[model samples]
Target chain A: MAIHHLESVFFREKVAEALEDQTLRGALQNATGLFRQRRLAATASLSDWEKLRDQARAIKAETLTHLDHYLPEFVAKAESNGIKVHWARDHQEACQVISQLVSEKQARRIVKSKSMTTEEIGLNHVLETDGAEPIETDLGEWIIQLAGETPSHIIVPAIHKTKAQIADLFVDQLSIEPTQDAEELTKAARRILRHHFAQADMGISGVNFAIAETGSILILENEGNARMSTSLPKVHLAVMGLEKILPRLADLEVFLRLLPRSGTGQHLTSYQSILSGPKRNPDQEGPEELHLLILDNGRSAILAEEITRQSLACIRCGACLNACPVYQQIGGHAYGSVYPGPIGAIITPQLAGLSETKNLPYASSLCGACRDVCPVKIDIPEILLHLRAKSVEAHENGKEAKGFRMWAWINRSRFRFVWAHRLARLGGRIFMKNGQPPQWLQRRAPVLGAWAKHRQVPTLAKRSFREIWKKELSRKQP
Target chain B: MTRNEEAKEAILQRVGQALNGGGVRAPRKHPITDQHYAGRPQTDLDLVSSFQEKLESVGGKVIRAQNLEQAFNELWSICQERGIRNLACSDAPSFRDLTDQAPEGLEILDFPHEQAELLEAEAGLSEAQLGIAETGTLVLDGEQENHRLTSLVPPVHIAFLSSKNIVLHLGEALSRAQQARSFPRTLTFITGPSRTADIELTLVVGVHGPRELVVFLLP
Candidate 1:
């Protein structure tokens, strides 16, 4: 099993590798293209999608502004309903709370649903290290876990794996006969997982929305694994980012409308579970104990800033990922983080800090497709620009920073701008081969060189546009 | 403070400081003003037919029973079609009446407290609180006679929904959900049979939950 850890340090090399894998590119293009089309069609039924987006954005913004108030309200309501709410300041603490809960139950086998929060905290690894076997119940999650890889997409984890490859994985792991049929592969997985579901002692899941009004956690899933995880297991733990809370149950109407459409282009997911607490009646079948972990892993830091705080409003629909051209080319693994798209680019650096993930912000072309398709209208490009500035400030007076400043100074005056253009053309000739800079120059120069390696560097015109305009004006006057 | 309490306090304090805490910013008045339905509002007749169409489109079977005899016939046929020999049912009145008339040789299991009976049954039955027409959703309130496993653990789930329980949209459902002083412990909105497309975006039905969901709508 490949160790699934952030390769942010080798972001460029990772992207280069992903670019060469035709299979990965084909799978991503096919999956993301379908998602983009479905979202358009699904949303076209609604005449007031923009208004709904505005309402969603406002509700999230207002709740975040009063998070201190809503968090306690949610805790109080949830606790009153027989749910034990735990707060974790960081990833380690979050893992400890869960580990304690698991040990307290003396649970040996654990089942988990698809949760980006669990992925962020590396929850499965922590549980396994503590002597509990955590089985991923979601089919996508199960396939990736079998292959010892993390999720490649937020909603569809194994989107990059071909059916043939999946069939092979099933044959190797579950000892099922190798078959090219997707349904057979799925049934083989189901046959094996159902046994674990019956024997599993605990289940862990992620919350899509935590409603403060009712103190309920909403989870949406197309597969019934999440339902099984919560239904069958005696102990269920819901790990949620503290920012997931909404002010009211009424707010869910808009989000519920937006989430399924933006995510998979479905009118609704197969199951939308709204759980408030553990079983109230002795006869009712649900977990005896419900534990809610509210995680604050550097999210408060992002919420402190006005511009970057809106990034916290993400619902994890993965719309931005599908809309991004750069993502279509490189795929999620290239971002080298648990999150691998535009949202990942902004939030990963914020959560992990800019020093290690600085290259992630520059991964985009700032084409604004992500922002345009964003259900909540999170100005993703604006956030990318903000992160770029932060990355620059962190490395103030560094070589690249100095070059940018120098370029900015020269472009401020007409003469320097024209002279710089002339020099650039001369440099172009000296470094050019077939109208593109050589890889060696890119290696030595490092800034433009790095970009030119992946993309074509624009050739300088023989005469400056400014000079040509001036000559034409003079000739017309004569 | 204990370790857990201390952690909770620290997180809340950080959130307070980040959002400028307590009386610093006045609470904004954000009203829930957009009452407009996103999709076209369906007429009363369209609600039933559209609900059936939408549910069927998502891989769920709808058996519209005009009366008690028709409903019983539908259940018998479902058992025969799926080769369901052992079945479990909720204590809902509709299901209880059907259990009395359940076919011979069809073993009827009770909702066991140990929950082992639910696992062995080929099919389980429950009565839905209501149905949402817009999304073709079944709203089940678990605090009632319905057990979560009755619809979940079995390979097949049969739900008995009444025609009058069908609503136009999610807003109506939310209002209905909010009617109680406190929310139910488990409130589920099930749209169709469990499915997945995780493997190369290939749609595969019956992943973990009920592979087949049959709804017998009572007139």
Candidate 2:
């Protein structure tokens, strides 16, 4: 398997570039604000929102802990229901399985609904390379795919793009007349994609929740493309991460309530297709064959560490992305991974090794907003801190570790701490002017330069708190 | 072993090892008592009105009818209003009687339709097996009546729902399906017409699915 490294630029450089793009920043701000406000209203409509979160989290915890038991049970039940099941240990195997199925069916034209798992595995590229034309049917995904870019947000893939940008892309790619009206753009996409759906030989989708008890997979979507994709095609393939399993069909009560409200602030999406298998003997519609590919893809490794395992509880609702302050400013593309925001910061590093994605763990300000909005109640900040520690431990002798060690040594005793602070104050007085570190000082201390690049150099207070306490405050208090 | 089997064994082994590892702790049990899974608090409104309100909020329209004849009358007017010359419908026995009453000059293509004909249909009519009030969702069982395409492909989808089938929430509808003798091969819960806010967060209805979802509640 090949490691697909994120974009070449460092995380800070990406942040700088993102901040410079005023249009992208404005789009992200508007989108996140809307999603946040809607999610608040939707959650408030439910009196048992907190209890639902707890129930969802508890279900996820139980399911993940005993996933080894449930996976087989699900496979057994699904097979009994006449759905062929395939297991993939990694992205390479997952892609290979899909490619084989495509070739076996000789499926040339394929239509797909929005699936983050497929994006993570880079499935479209593989299919295209194999001489298959895979069309993304989701409106946002189609827009991004046409622009030759990746999704910027989980739920709303084109969140960072303005309507004008999409209009330009449509004019350039689809050769349609340019229009800024969202309805017109959507109508254009629907007109074009419906043709693909009519001719498509294969359909692919992602599983929202796979019930072990009933051997059914529920796919929730608002656009109804998922239904068309899975229903119209001769062969339907669903790819799911191992963690998508729930023990019983009843568990959907909690998740179905939480996911839509958290993602798009809807009571329910337009369509929830609960499919148990392919079309039955007497059925006149639906796919002739159904294939379910369960991909591990480093999730079991995440499950190894108890704290990190909580990251897998995510349902990919994108609620955390909406609530995250860092994500609001920098946006999803800045993370340079398929998954982004607070959940992405934790997940990307674990799935793709920490070394490749080391900077992602530090992306958050530890404000706990993501945890608060997480439908499954994943302790994302705690997992982020744990990943940061892992990153540091991996590079024990690196500059960051040495800097931390020096700072810790300086604060070992009262005398050393006070003396170090006074020395820093003296340096601050010389090197810092009007809260700006001089260029020479920045060049001389590369660490400080890197830190101050994105932030203002804090000025030491005119009088230290200790000095004020020792001089006048003590006597005044008495 | 073949590659597929090898991968499966490896994955199961890894999962087992991860679960047994010292770092992973046993999950705290949360038994689903009725207290934990109680239905949402009920308001004073009736289920049908609640369903109508919930559905209408999401861009779906609901009509109240005294009987199938009244529902068919409303459907004919809608078809006339939309200038629908051809309509596709499900083949459920109940719908067969409704299709027979199709106004002159209107082509009623029943289920088991050719893909091309279904694609060009101006409107479609189907039957909902259950109605969920909390979300204003209609449950369509594909096996019972071949409605997968009729309710989905057309720009206008009008579904007939018996008032007695309306439930308070999704859980009740799902539980009924679970308790059924044979679960539906495919059950679709539709809350509204297909919509998207993907382009700059602008709400666009009737994207890939029906643009107009009209449900007639038959008493």
Candidate 3:
């Protein structure tokens, strides 16, 4: 439960099942298409949408390149402002720290706002294991918690469920009279949640950004619940990814404009929380203690890589997922990782390594829809190719000694490579009939065949394009 | 140290300045200064309206006007129709103007205290600098009171913005934000109502923030 990788494995299998399920596919397509349209409309309103994307990309890239400098400053400033800070290497450690805080409070019940990091760490499950009940206060998260399902979309978590299904859940779980009406369902959730908020012992949330210049944890939301989550609860725990740090507080003005337009096509979310330590001095109804857990969870590895480090610039706005054509067909679950989109396909492998998430690289169409819509403007398709190459390299290293060992050994030598290329050319000549591709290439080759499984083999001309282009260029130069 | 500090130090333990001349000091690429942002994206205000038109094209309700007064009237009527009181507003001039115009019985609080006092209110109203149609987000800064808590504390939040402020995407806003002399302590770009599907993957609104957001755009 503490590991995103383990959940990823479960997710991959579940998504594969989801893909084959006709009903699920239909629902996913409908919802993703709707969100994509909304995002497109929202982005169109910005006169310089593309330029803005470029700027965001630049800021994140610049900040991350110098994160070592920024993070410490943020900590110093936030600490000076009176906030307690903690570090977690991974979800396991993150959960332990949160549980410790709750236990120290001796608080039996905890109220939670929506936080993806909590999901990343499986904090609720972890809380339960340690004998604390963590109630999800975010309406969508609350529903999923009650039904025991994973979020279907980053922005709209429970996008896959219907009203009737929710009514049944309420009827079964809360013993409420079942009604298929969405309004009635919402009221039921509200009535039950208000009571939990009034008496919650602790509150937990996720941070959208942590300003280094000033001690600030910025959160975006639509519900009033998070305010209550932190205010009503005696203790508040905020968990965030390390990359959520921005250089200064005013920098938020840009992101504030970007995130809402990209994620759910709203002008702004209903709520934005900027917490500056717990109730300073004498305050009426805020958390007595404030804790911020910043998690690395193998992010440094991605940062270390030159090609993949741009992945860190991601704000987790979920725009790429919504804009992605592939994602529209398959939905987030199909990506089979917490990331679940163009960003996930590129990032999961880097964090987990190509060895674990090998299939994620090939999940994209390379149509560049995700890159086109990214608010932070990550070069997602390029990263997808980069990760794909890494995955292929891992496979080609031929970890297992098998039939390909001899072929790889032969291929290692330059002389052999030349001869092999000529021989391959000759074989291509033999296989060609008119313009039709070779029948042997039709089925799929083996390790080489992986590409062929879902791709088309370019028809070999009498001469390779490289040779023709070289000859023409030579003539022109002379 | 706060949770942010201890954790940042631990992470810093792994990040050797090996990349930055082996120095712990961060690169000062640009100091915070106020100037007309050069790289900030500029689009004719008309394009922003097109963005609004597009959102409306896709089944979203949008209001366009010239200033906060018109935006407020539209917002007031919208909330008043719902019989809402106990509203929260960040201490911005636009939001204050709306509060002044609010009906007598409809209570309005100017954001929350550091202790989150105003969070008890039923509704929240705030001023947003711009609306990005791309993510359907409204971007704001915590420079003013209630700038952070006003939009978050109330269940139903109504945000006011001028039509000129509407942008196409988060990136556009960031570009403009870079031009600020000093960025606020925090920036929040909110897209939809606060939501989470943590339980049984059921979509719920207003979990950690406001559930309903109405943006009144004045030209």
Candidate 4:
């Protein structure tokens, strides 16, 4: 299992690879574009969509503020409702607990419903190392698993793989005949997974929301596989983040209105399940033991930062991923972590350590599209700047961030301020002219150089923003 | 300390230092507001009709029945057509009445009642505490053993809803739940079944939930 303490250097290389690959560009652009369109259409029915976003943000903010209270209460309530809850501070321990259960159950085969949390924890690889044959039931996740690749998109894990590629992969992995048609492709994949579904001893999944008031785990999906994974299997293990908690059962109402509209642009998801606990006594079919692994994995660090804390408000609807310009071009693979897109750019750096994954913070156009489409209304561009500061702080112990502090000191003196402006403008022109543009635009990681790649300085017109504003003001004064 | 505990402790310490407190909470400046449902009604009937209208808009069938007996007749007919016999629910009086009205050997159980046990049932019959008309949501409370698991763990869930308990928006239903003064230890607002977009952005339903949800709307 790859204990991916991924470094910034790795992300830079991957981003470079993504830039060079037009095939990946087309796939990402195509998929994100469709998602954006669908999402827009879905939200159109709601007249007060913006207001709804604000409301959702307020609710999340309120929950987080009282999270110290809510978290303990949620834990207690879930336990009361017959949920076996375990707290994992990081991915490795989370995996250990799951594997221990698998060992305890003597499980040889496992099936999974689609969960980004499991992906973040690298659960599949861990299980495989433990000699458990884990099968990804979701079609996209299944493809990525079979291909030995990480998910490139939050919602569409196999967005990089075309239908023909999937057909071929299926033929290779399973002795199934291939067809190019999507329905046929889906049927083929489903046929392969159906047997695994009936045979798997344990199931793993991710929660959409852990309702604190009810201790009900909300999972929304379109396929019957999640049903089977948690239902047919003897034991079900769910991995969730602490941030996924909402205080009341009523909160699901707001999330339901927002999630599908922001994610797939559906007014309502096809299947919504409220899993209270393990299967009841004499129940027809459901998991015997239900265990929830609440993973922290560096989120508390993110929570401590005033700026980046808003990033935690994300619902993982992938709306921001589709809305991000940088993500649309390079795809999820370039990010080199479990999370991808604009959200990943900010989140991955924090989770893996900014010193190690600092390049991720730079992977944005700062177009503010992610913030625009975010259901929970996280101000991503602002968070991006905050993370950039955190990254610099991580590197210089305060020196890398000294540039801003230096500018602040310089700004107090008109002489130093003007001098600095002249120097910066002249430098911008020189770098813009002599550096071959691509050198600056080229990021080793999608999070870096991605902006400069598609944009250029218009040969700084011998003026800065202050100077331009001053001249405009003088003209108006006349 | 275990690896996870160490991580959590590290997070707590790091964040605590940053926030300048042993533990500090992040709070938003303003209250939340919902502006999605335009021209939604304040009247209960409006809420029920609006939600009913939406369910129908999504190619779903929504019919108003006069009583529990009428609802059961319709459900039984559907079950018979589908060859379903076993049923599970979260012990609602209406559902209990329907189960009592059922023929012998029609298996039924209120779900998630016994931890770590499987109820080898085919169909499920459950009653919703409250229904949201705008988004087509069914409210479930866990303090009642029957509410949470009945719809989720079953294959086919026939959600028995009374029209009188329907609300216009999620906010209304939620506010009402809180207004009930003493809150249930666990409240579940189930909008639909368990679903996922993890697979190639394809939406799949019945993932860790009931594949078929048939709402029994009664007067």
Candidate 5:
């Protein structure tokens, strides 16, 4: 099944709509500012922060290049460790495998920890359609699930919501007393989710890092929901993109040091659960069966390109999202992708296809803040430019391509350039009023109308620069 | 071949084709040894003090005890102060003896119980295999302790750590685990109690995990 996007097609319309929301913009500014400050402080504490980034990037490069050699090795080791490894070629097959597991186990109540891979595959929708209930246990995921919306940010999923809005949402969906106290709200979620944990027969989570040598998967979370979901249930299912692999267990040290600091500005998250496999003994308290689903889901296609493959190194830290100016203005929803911000701008076009998510690459101003804060040192802006060129190439007959061609044509010769400039100035003289384009002119030219909707269009100079230089500057100068 | 095997083969083929294609550049060799943290505590005293400060920074309470007996006494007092009647504990050797020496009213329920009973316990107790001073983290090995839920399901968790087991950094702790005969089924590194700031960026402590973590360091 193709990955479902909330709104990548009409990117400009979504961005405009997002710009109109005052509360969302305020929430985003506060959250992003706080994350940026914390990340800075956290990274500064480490003297080897720069060295760690280089090491992490190198490790990811090596592993991704030789992934075929590691995949089977991981599968062999994980299976020997009592984990049943499943492979899926796409999102549809991944969801189908999970649905089959749910039915096979006769699991009705399924608890889920936050996993972006599952979100990309639309797993909850599939499970709900199959008559199985999948409850999101992470505090932010649960809130968005209740709101019938998607995450606005990767790290803080509900960063777009105000406390008042959350309280109202809680009152409406959870039927709790309406209170804006974050503590009380969190308590209510814990109380309810705990009940679900007690009843759940199956649990699902995402993998942060999968070690090939040890056949172990590491899950990092602040809330204990991940632990509960993986432990309380009889069966545990972990979903991951195939790129989330490391060749050796020892390599985790570099990533472990980098991820928390870059993502949340913490030395380490509250909990890091490293599980090699299911319970070794019946007396132990853990899942009886552990299933690991490794999904390609367009990542292989992304890896096929040298320029785009660096995107797979992302740890989903959200530091780039916090640093991105475009993400700050539009928030995550405007991009209409599970992955957003600068990283999303590059990855979405490649994974979802340039035709469907062409506007995503243009979402950034290419300021390179994402690259600066990226733990894996992914050159996000470079990839963004690459994807933009690909988009233009794919749509060669489109108006944007035609406009570029016209621009190049006019600029090829001084005579044509001067004539075009004079023609534009004449039009400006007729249609511009006090340095603003006339409403009629805006209406006549839809592209100009869209461009001028949120901006001031300066009127062309009364006389050409060359004319002014010849007539005034020449007389004044020596 | 089964469908799953065929899928694996197809994925490997794609990966091989992608790598062998001229599109990808040759992979660079990573350094075998990473630079150790320069700021990590160098001495035992520094490690102890740093561990205490780091753990305390994240809202975990640390109590220094002269010995295991003193640590048990501290645990008893904490339970009494909090009005904890039922305390669940792991079957690990360090906590196994607590059931016999529990104070009059405090009932120490060891693991091997039903999951429902564990959920009802007011507090949980477990022993750490190692403590990381740099991040104030506790490393727990599930192979050594049978009850993984003992430290997770309850609202309050009390952990006992030996001062000698404290390491200077995460790399040291991980290296020690790597040197083991085989990796444990589950190894957890916990820095503090469960927390979240997701709702309007408001920091809320104790979401789904224990709200309070109390560690008694034994000499």
Candidate 6:
């Protein structure tokens, strides 16, 4: 994948690098702006949008609360529909199961849709290592694959690329004449990938909503690439997060309205496929075999936490990504994860654990724009704060802990408090150069200086308010 | 235990534990409410025009015919305009009248016997089970013989939809589907032709599936 996986601490460095690129900034602004406008317009048609959000939230919460029951029901229904179900506790296990299936089928060529689950497990890399070609058929995914990169946005994966850049990529990779027109470029990709779609022995897709009652998996896509990937191949495999299941088919009415409106502002995506199983007879010309892999991959850990489990309600609409002020500036690759933006900041830490992903929670401004747009009403900012507190608790013996200790000591009594104020005034006088703090303060005073990097330090008053109060009292008595 | 069985056990156990709050509470059930759409008809116009306007807005063509004769005429003219000679069609009775009157030199590859011909054919024709007015979507199930590939693989797809099958909203369609014995292995709610805005946000039609979708609404 072209998206580099760096430790979360490099978030700042990545943000800085992304901000420095003028072309990338323009592309991000244009793409996110269009998405934001369209989403606003799409939802503007409805009067009960908030009511719908609440209903969606309640439904997800209910389904997850009884997951132990609902999951088995889904499995049974899926099995009865001539579909095979596999369970994996982690990404490694998920990859292993898929690899076993590939080997069993002797599938040399595999075509795939834009599935974050596959990306989450690094499935393409695994397939390559296992000698099976995993070809991404989605246009955005295909471009990124050719460029050796991962998706930058959930809806528009290659949003960072301009038409000229895409043309250049096609010219280099597909040996086509360089053209900047988007339609011509798409035509070139279609001509090239059409053959691969027909030749692929197996197809892999990601599920948007798995209707447990009907034993059907819904895949939402504007491009028909996903439809092709599932239809042309002899065998079809769909991988889904365990939390993607819905309790009833009727719930799709709410989600089907919310998802497209929030994602790219389409009334409905060009194609919404509700595939229950593979081709059943000579009548249907779909895949002969169908397999669905329900992957847990640390989502159960999220479900285990009472406060943060609501994060699983996310429908991956990418609405929050467009609404996020921070995401609009830095784009998704800066987060260094398959999922990015507000949902990513909250869920990635829990899914991957806090040790390496602790810095992710700090990647937000807590503006609640994400919560406003989330179809399932995941309280993203609240979850971010929760994760931040958890991260701090794990770092109790660190610099912040010492700073809090000093703060406690100063507020113990009047004398110490006065002395602390005096010391602060003196430090400000010494540190202030040209009426501003020097750049070296960041290196010298680690905590305060780090805070000063993106903000202005509040100047200490010339005289303490306590001193002025005492003098005024003495004057009144006289 | 076998790995698959052990994995399932571990997952289900984790879920039970999570719902139980690590032994703090007991498993609880949450009530699910259905009939969410208020069960009111929102559209003022007749179902066919509403469905037609909605479908055409998304780049799909809706040919309105009062009877099967006019429907066949519209289809024949469409085939002439597209210059389609070999059209793959479904074996549904709704399209039987049109198939019988298929233009001269037009070879209809009727399924399930000719299902394999859809892949190589330029155009495919099938009868939709339902037409949704709210989104201009055609609902088709996989259980129907010659339904799947006839509408998917070909560059152009022509669907025959009856006026009676038109619904006011998706909720109506869902309720109908819910009452069914069981959903087929595959179903589709196609709104427009296969399109993508993936490349620099420019709309490109016909990425993988049929580039063109034409529907004939018969009264």
Give Cα-based local distance difference scores for all models.
0.86, 0.89, 0.69, 0.71, 0.88, 0.84
Q: List the residue pairs that clash in candidate 2.
A: none
* Runs in model 4 lying further than 4 Å from the true structure: A1-8, A279-285, A392-478, B1-45, B63-130, B138-165, B172-216
- List each candidate's DockQ score: 0.67, 0.70, 0.20, 0.24, 0.71, 0.62
Best by DockQ: 5
**Cα lDDT tens digits for candidate 6, A274-336:** 888877665566888989998888888788876888999889999999999999999998888
Q: What digit string (tens of lDDT, one per residue) describes model 3 on residues A1-478? A: 1335344545456656776877666767767776678777877766777766766676677678878888878878777766788888777778778888878899878888878778877788888989988998777778788999777677677766766777888899999987876656777887788778766788888888888766778777666667677656768888888888888655676676688778877556655767767654442235677888878887765666556778888888888877777777677776666667788888777766666677787777799888777888788889888877766666765544455687798789978876766777787677745544455665555544544544665554556555777878667875
| Per-residue alpha-carbon lDDT of candidate 4 for residues A1-478, written as tens digits (9 for 90 to 100) | 1225344457777877888988778777777888889998888887777867877888787766555556666878888867888877778878888999899999989999899888778788789899999998877788888898887877777888876777788788887766665655665665567678768899888998887776778787766567668767788888898888887776666787899888888787665666778755653335678888888777776666556777778888999888888888788888878788888877887777666677887888799998888988888888788888767666674544565677689999989988977887776666565443446444543433554555653555687777888878667875
Task: Write the number of the candidate with greater DockQ, choosing between 3 and 4.
Answer: 4
Q: Give a tens-digit lDDT track for model 1, residues B61-102.
A: 998889878887878877887688988887776665455787
True contacts kept of each: 0.75, 0.77, 0.29, 0.35, 0.80, 0.73
* Candidate 2, lDDT over the whole model: 0.89
Winner by lDDT between candidate 6 and candidate 3: 6
Ten residues in sequence with the least summed lDDT for candidate 4 chain B: B32-41
| Cα-based lDDT at residue A3, candidate 6 | 20
Worst 10 residues of 6 chain A by lDDT: A1-10
Please count the clashing residue pairs in each candidate, in the order shown: 1, 0, 93, 47, 1, 2
**Ten-residue region with minimum lDDT total, candidate 5 chain A:** A1-10
Highest TM-score scorer: 5
Say which prediction, candidate 4 or candidate 5, comes out ahead on DockQ. 5
Q: Model 3: which docking level applies?
A: incorrect
